[model samples]
Target: MAKIEDQRIVIDCTCEVQLQQTIIDAVYLALKLEKEICFFGNYLNTSEKEHLQQRTAFYANFVKKDIPSLPVSVLLLEGKLNKLVKELGEKYNTILYCYSGAMDNRLLEAFYRSGFPFYFSKKQVSNSNQFSKILIPVDFRNSSKDSALWGSYLGRFCNAEIKLLVANEKNTEDQDLVASNTESISRLFNQFSFPWSSVLGNSSSWGIHKEAVKNEEPFDLIIFAGSLNVTLVDKITGTFEKRLVNLSEKSVLLINPQRELYLICS
Candidate 1:
């Protein structure tokens, strides 16, 4: 999307869905975006022995159902495509999501090596750019503020309503702090002429995160930002981010310089 304008680009990434279907849906989203769109689909190349025929059949079905919509220069390639991506430049770019269920950092390194700038979930990059409504979970910490800034930016762009969520233990003191922060954010939004808004919940760290992601509402988008769980411990450290990546049915952005999980959206 380098040469493309900002509003003309959208991105969708998924680990589920038939590989070819994912590509087709991406094409649909891109076209609907009325801008350039690129969808990244990754298959475990090493697993070919188990499902090569099945995989091929899936792709065949996709072509049968949808490939006529390929809009000219949309380049689709597989294998260790890092080099091919470099040659193609940035007009269109993608890297493999193959991890062998190991969550290897090597894939992240490979993505950068391939020259793809930013990545996005299928929901975030969809044509629904305006926020008719949004749910943002925040703690009192500065980390939550990181998410706030991004959400505020989006709200300003879309003029959409907002909901700031927090989890509580019913303590009066914590409640007061939550009140102050909520007021501050609301005032900021009004100052910028953002739309209507409100806040809920308590200030626990994981509380805000889990509640926000697990919220049963069907808001247009939910954001958890700055750094979610970036502790030194092994499992739960990156695990929080991983859960959001794999488990989320919504678009989740897990950004942190330490984890090198920044999202590149043009």
Candidate 2:
């Protein structure tokens, strides 16, 4: 775990219609967690790079107007986009990216492979960017812990309630693992005195997201753990990670399973 002050959120600034909403969401989170914001722009040529410098500055000022106390910076990243994103991921704990339907899958995949947690949304920022209810779909994987940790952080900062949607596993081994994972997450929440509740899904792990989206409770945020192993079917259709992001209208916080995530110190 790292001090909360050490956390920084990198916001990918683009010339998309949803850019304003993305900045609003990033600034809201930064204010809530007392973290700094770095507006990042990726460029291909010197001309574009120079233009991005000004663009990032404008966005920075946009955030500053709403959040005067928050610290902000701008970075013009040149060279490969994915490589630069990976490097940025190594430095920042979280990245905020908006899906604009144009090359969104590629942009999201880059973040996914970057091995960092990311907040993705196609719609506008949540009302006042207040996530009072968070949903975390749990399964029999170590990665579930990462998502749970994020859920606890949001729960603490936003004064939100956490709901763990546990997977219904038929296999004996998987059932034991799911139970173990669920208990561990519950203990983590209890340790922080964060309010949490759980419900068993009627479907297996594969169908968990469908169940989550259909949940009666209106969650402001959904924290999902990225799949470590992408199956062949995922290649043809799409990874469950992308599917969840696309399917859910609510904001999603994705935790990459392959990386060791940083936690906010209490």
Candidate 3:
């Protein structure tokens, strides 16, 4: 439903205990969509490699217990991560990393530069049912619009409820931008068929994160948008947009501004 089929997902399995389930769940979710799931197995130690394979096999078997025709593959990590990603970039649509707070910022910048729909989660997320609540943070930028459409597609695919959070910034210019962004997003989502809503917020990441966690009903996903074509300079300078990825409590989906979803898939 999300054009997940016929897509390739390269998973970085170089994480430890707490992240193991994240990798397993990622593979399971991908298999459910019949996507080409590829695990980078070369960098892992023997035990880690074995664990990854065993868990992958378990999920694949579970997914295919009755379906019998799931698409999955195990690829060697081969060499450096950036190198592997460069190679995978030609074929894969998304590079998934089950990272905690330990990952280097440089590596993330590399993924952004690689122009893939880089999907990452710092915590475990359940794939047992459709995502019921997806959150999209809106700003007056083209990237935010891309994120809105992408989140809408995911909402439709999962039959989820999608909400837009227009963060009210401090200055008049920023506040006006948020209002304009909200209106534009409302018009855009109106074209889609899904249960959707919107709320104006008084702050960015912190407020949104707090609201998300404080909700008696939690959000299943957070989709962010930014100049995915990030530069070394931007990382050094530290952009607020880049900081949104640090929200590790829930599953976060980031749409690269440099890479648009293939129209064929749409």
Candidate 4:
């Protein structure tokens, strides 16, 4: 992670009042990383744009009082948000979108296929962006290693505790490898001085989500790795990835396997 301070973040500045919370959360992420924040300012007309500008400025000030150091910019969508995002995704390292649960599926597909690691969340972020506990669901795959590294980076950055949850069926063929992978992940996190632990369980994403919902202590963030879907078999029966995203309430950091993991900066 080469001091990843220069980040380009694109967020939809829709005029919906409900979206305001998510927008502020997104800005908080940018502030955490001191990254450049970009907004699609064309989503609103003159009066609405003025109101939104005020709101955005307020959030920016709330996060960082030093206005000169905060690199915030607005781009006109011109009714071509999808196309503009495709271009931006190619040029940027990190992209954060305010997912209001009603975005077009096609647009999301574009984000997935854009080859950039992106963040999506419907819930408001914590007032303090210091993630106390971070969870990474591990499977016996190369992408899981990538995800673990990311979790370690974030854990160190936030001075947080990291945990890797290994979920698998009892009858799975690679049970031994799963155990080995857990040990490997533990060692990796330990190198980063991240207090780490492991949880072994056989459950689906829905079950994990249910437990998190009921637990007194919930994870602040869940990190996931993107699948290539290279093989025909893997394409047909995708893992619990999508379900994990839909069923969880915490923030998600999705890593695109196609791109170099080093590009996934804070």
Ranking by TM-score: 2, 3, 4, 1
Count clashes in each candidate, considering only residues at least 3 apart in sequence or on different chains. 9, 0, 0, 0
* Overall local distance difference test of candidate 2: 0.74
Candidate 3's error at 133, in angstroms? Answer: 0.7
CA RMSD of each candidate after superposition: 7.4, 2.6, 4.6, 5.0
lDDT of residue 41 for candidate 4: 47
**Local accuracy by lDDT, each model:** 0.46, 0.74, 0.59, 0.59
Candidate topping TM-score: 2
Q: How large an RMSD does model 1 have? A: 7.4
User: Candidate 1: global Cα-lDDT?
Assistant: 0.46
The TM-score values for the models, in the order shown, are 0.52, 0.89, 0.72, 0.70
Give the least accurate 10-residue stretch of model 4, judged by summed lDDT: 207-216
Model 4: per-residue lDDT, tens digit, 38-138?
65544436776676677656655554555567677655543344465555655544355444343344344544555555555555455576367777777
At residue 34, what lDDT does model 4 achieve? 63
**What are the clashing pairs of model 4?**
none
TM-score comparison, 3 vs 4, better candidate: 3
- Model 1: lDDT of residue 104: 34
lDDT of 2 by residue, 180-266 (tens): 999898888998866899999997777887788777248877888877887789878888778767777777888878666655544
lDDT rank order: 2, 3, 4, 1
Collision pairs in model 3: none
